[model samples]
Target chain A: MLSDIAFLFYFFSLFISFIGSCIMFSKIEIAFKWIGILLIVTFLNELNTRFLVKSLSIQSNGVYHFFVPIEFSIYTIIFATFINLKRWNKILILLVFLLVIIEILNTLFLQPIYVTNTNTMIIESVFLVLLSLILYIRIKESTYYKNLLLEGVFWFNSSILFYYAFNILVWGFHNWDFINPPLIMYDINAFLCGLMYLTFLFSIYLNFIQVRKLKN
Target chain B: MTNRQIESIDVIVFIVAGILVILLMFGFILYFLISYKSKKRDYNLLEIQKKELDDQKKLLENTLSELRATQSQLIHSEKMASLGQLTAGIAHEIQNPLNFVNNFSDVSKELLTEMREDIKKNNIEDALELASDVVNNLDKIYFHGKKAESIVKGMLQHSRAAKGLLEKADINLLCDESIRLAYHGMKSKFMDFNVEITTIFAQNIPKIYIIPQDIGRVILNILSNAFYATIQKSKKISSDYKPNVTIKTLYDSSGVNVYIRDNGCGIPQEIKDKIFQPFFTTKISGQGTGLGLSICYDIINSHGGRISFESKEREFTEFNIFLPNKSNLVVKIPNNVV
Candidate 1:
């Protein structure tokens, strides 16, 4: 029953984020609309993870298999950089588009259909860390953009950090149980992903509100 | 792990998320309230300042109008003083001639009475000659006395105090009367010049609320300037370019506009602006006191009006006077009532 309530909260958050995206599209400004689109996509991706887990009967290993940490990390870095270095919008746009293409390719082709290997996880985790570092650098340099973008980066990066650290701990020190664990690490991952998507949605909403104020 | 343990963990996470969301919402509400309060305070301050500014403007306008009225009163007083002096001199001049007419007419009456008595007693020859002589003396007294009386009457009318008795007066009647009075007064002093006066009065002008005599004086002053300009120009140019003065009246949204234009050697552009200043004149020394246009300016301003002029050297000069209409009921009030 409690798990069902958490699922409901996650779904409610997704609904709000989707409505916020629609508001951005209704606005005339291109920058706000694009940021809103990015938030909706990230939320949808997170929602799909939960749906796949339930409908496909994807166990813990299946959960880790299909979802790539690299995608969120890259988006976080690109959005943070875009907010910070708007003067280089043309170059940043090109770079982000290329990274998205690479992410799609890797997700579709590189990893096996049902593998949960530590090597594959570490490789994806390293790319995420690199992306997080770039995002952190942008947040450090920007003054006005720091507060909002930093909140998004903090949620996403901390989630990635916790997931990777816990994984490493469980694999290296603790007895590996195939069926169940001492802690609900999967639930924690789900909660953190929900938080990351919520923060991203809030940041996009903030951008749209600021643009609307300027237009008025 | 039991199902109870999983439920407990889920409850803890859910409670924490709910608390965080409530806290964030509270913070946003607080921010909005503070911003709205500050903006309302700023708007109130601006409204107060605007009200204060409007009050100050009204006060300033009142003071300015009062100052103008006082200035005109001073000018009127000065005019009265000068007119009083002229009146004394004119009265003395007319008195001598009048006394001679009166004394001669009395003597002629006595002579005719004696002649009638002699004719009744049958002294025909002496009575006839005496009667003819009495008749000739009566004719002389009648002609001279009538002439002197007309001159004195004209002088009295010209020098009358301007009580500023505002009334609905016809502009054409006022203009013609003023020009006639001014010509009668000044023509004898300045000889050998035929000044052409033309009136281009607009037909069907509504009766304007103004002091007829005061406005007449203003027109007379402008005409005097035109005549002076013509005299000055005649010295340099041929007599063929005959001097002409024109008075025109028109009405529009801005009330009645009177234009007094002259084709005399126009005022120099440099001195044109100064012409309306008190005691500023281009006339030769001792010929003019130079208070004319200044008085005109004061009169028009007191009527809630303005006077402006345009002049081109040796071409033409035009003075435009704009007077507000009856809609300005406050200004239309008589001075005594106000």
Candidate 2:
């Protein structure tokens, strides 16, 4: 059942990513480029998870466990920095860089305090919540892409928040009875993230319309 | 998933997306460059057409001025030909009187000699009667001969043929002569009505190259209009009120300006625009040809100068003429070079 769920997730992500790519190809604006890039990255990550589940044995001790948080942190920081660099201050750049370096160092050097599946899930959830909060603040203050960009950020942040909260509650408290129903929660995140990508693409199209109107 | 697998997937996606973005950006830049170049070409074409149109307008104005000058020369030649015919008629009329003066003078001289011989023989009554007849015949010959000579002289001056030749001439003297010539024709009609003529001439105006006859004609036309306007107004008002006309001239750095003004029945606005048009007259049938102002307009235009007027109905009218000082020399230079 876990392998089947992983395959479905992988295919679903690929389908969403394909649609995002077509949107990017259609004379879209600059902001959507970032959203498209993020969607493709997530799709690849899901596909990799699907492959791992198919080829390898099901085990709590996975070699990729330590790399996930480090990879997530690096990608999020890079994307956020690129989009917000026009508003960049030296202090903000230094703070975000410091946080990324610390996360990387922790993933590379720190040993596990306790051997449990819950600990890994708890750490990942906490990091996702922190990243979502930062992204929400950045998106709220931005004026260039306006309502559509804000809608995108709202969907993306809420999806991440819900996923993290659901995971933490499901694993940290050992709530095994609700596990089957909550598996669908991951799909909900995927759907919401797809909607976020679509809204971001529409916002770019709107910007193009505005530019054409001004020229005439 | 293994860390190496995840890292490979991320690198592949990044590379693909980056390539797509670079290609799209290049396409946009190319489109913008093409649009900009076409807009610039359109602006340049519009500018060139505007310059060509301005050149055409200037050429048309020059052609119009030349046509006006040619027309005026033709009219002046026609007037001169008619004047020559009139002069020949006057000469024929004087010839008959002139012959009698010559024949009678000779006959009277012979009679005087015979009477002188008779007087020497002491015939007192016969000598007295013959002496009275000789005195009477001498008076007739002197009076008739002098009258014919004065008439010829007046005809010669009125013809203005000698004055038409270019010479260093005073404009003030020319104005006075033209006024005298016009008054000869106008005085009889205005004799019973009170009319005053005044002249204010400017001194030391440099001699200008012109045909004095043509200038004389312009002065005559303006003075005629002034007299007629005044006469018409006086008839409407009290008979005792005297009409006044003033002629004045001024010389400046640019040119000379002549003004003829009168306290008269001023031209109405409706007729003012048509005043210089040929055959457009306010006079009754057979009273005026209406070619006077039209001819004046043509003459001034040919001289590379202008004539204009101002009038307030029932109050006053002023005709202003400006003739450039060196216009003849300036105009000839261009023709000579071309």
Candidate 3:
């Protein structure tokens, strides 16, 4: 029953994100559109992994290995748009793409595909938090000082920061199996996912409102 | 993997991640606050610079207008001084003509009385001769009277404040009249003063478009300076000193040129450039206002013309005034004449 409730909460968040993206699709900037697309992709990834694991009784570790690196690349690209340094932005995107490629190769050949890629996930989470931190610093030092509360990207990065920062512990404990797992842990995990999607919904909606205000 | 190993790894990872998050959060907050403070400081500095620029612009505008007002005041003062000096010469010039008219009238009166006496004695031929003599004497009186009237008319024209308006002026006549007025002026001011004046006016010189009154003042100014210089030279050298001023007017396709040369104490090379500057004079403090040449230069320059001088110290000085016949005027001489 609790798993069913967690599933409902996760899908509910995704539905909200879908509505937010649709609302802003025609009016938002290119960078902002990429963010909406990323939200849809995340929802699809979660749906596919759940279907394969529950119905087919197949492990979703391989799916995660493939999806994780791509997600990192997309997030890096989204943040790169926020960076004002022209040459450095391209360099940073290229560096992150190369790193993702290396991690995928390591997972396919060196590590077993059946096992959870816990160590790599922890590294990815830490790296993502670092990138979000870099973005925070850049925004602070910018000459075109925007109010952090008004900016969609600020909230988006902050969501990324909090999610990855706390998820590092979950990745570390992925191998553990207690006799009776604490129900609260699963609920907390669902709550974190819900928070991330809600943040996405809010950011996309804010972008739509801002664009409309500018048009008027 | 054993639950013991997994739990141990989780404990270590959680501690590291927690510490890193705490440090990053602190750093980000600190940096944001500092950047905000710096941005506020930069905005304040920019505002101060903008205000300073506005103040500087206002100061420059005030100074420019004050300079313009002072310039017109100086020109007016110089014009008045020139008029005052010409008044003395006009008075002296009219005196000779009036004396001749008076003498001729008295002689004609005597001849008329003699004609009446001869007619009473029946001397008809003698009476007719006396009548002819009286008529000649009356003609003399009429000629002198007209001469005095012309002098007064010329002086009136000179005395009027200049309009500085360009017109088709006979350049030769203008120069001759200025020379006469200037020479008579110096003679009236100093009784013992005498200078040999020579004028070579080009005949049929095309009428040059000019501000006659302004150019007339310029001509008078240069002539007076030339006369004054020669007078000084004459006083210094007792022997072989013949004060002479020669004026020549020439014309070409380009323009009309007037040359006023004098045998005088020439301009020293050291002070040559300073001559055209306002308030610079070689004369004793009270004798000269020192604005003569500067005003002459300004007047010529305003008419799209130029005034320059060539001089050898203690020998001779020649001033050349060239007026272009072109219509493009650089300076807008005001039409209001006071």
TM-score of each: 0.37, 0.35, 0.57
Residues forming the 10-long window of minimal summed lDDT in candidate 2 chain A: A173-182
Clashes of 3: 0
Q: Please, what is the whole-model Cα lDDT of each candidate in the order they appear?
A: 0.62, 0.60, 0.78
Candidate 2: Cα lDDT at A211: 51
lDDT of 2 at B114: 73
| Residues A1-216 of candidate 1: C-alpha lDDT, one tens digit per residue | 546655667667667777767766675345445546656665676667767677876644444443444444445445545446655455445555555555445446763445454444545544444544455445444433323333434444444444444334333222243333434444444454455556656656556566667788
Residue-level lDDT tens digits of model 1 in B213-297: 6676677677767766777777789868888888888877658888888887888878877987877877677555566777778
Pick by TM-score: 1 or 2, better one = 1
Query: All candidates: CA RMSD in angstroms?
Result: 17.4, 17.6, 9.1
lDDT of 1 at A151: 41
Model 1 regions lying over 4 Å from their true place = A1-216, B78-100, B106-156, B159-267, B273-291, B294-338
lDDT of 2 by residue, B114-172 (tens): 78888898887877777888788788888778867865765565454333244455677
Sort all candidates by TM-score, best to worst: 3, 1, 2
Cα displacement (Å) at residue B160, model 1 = 5.7
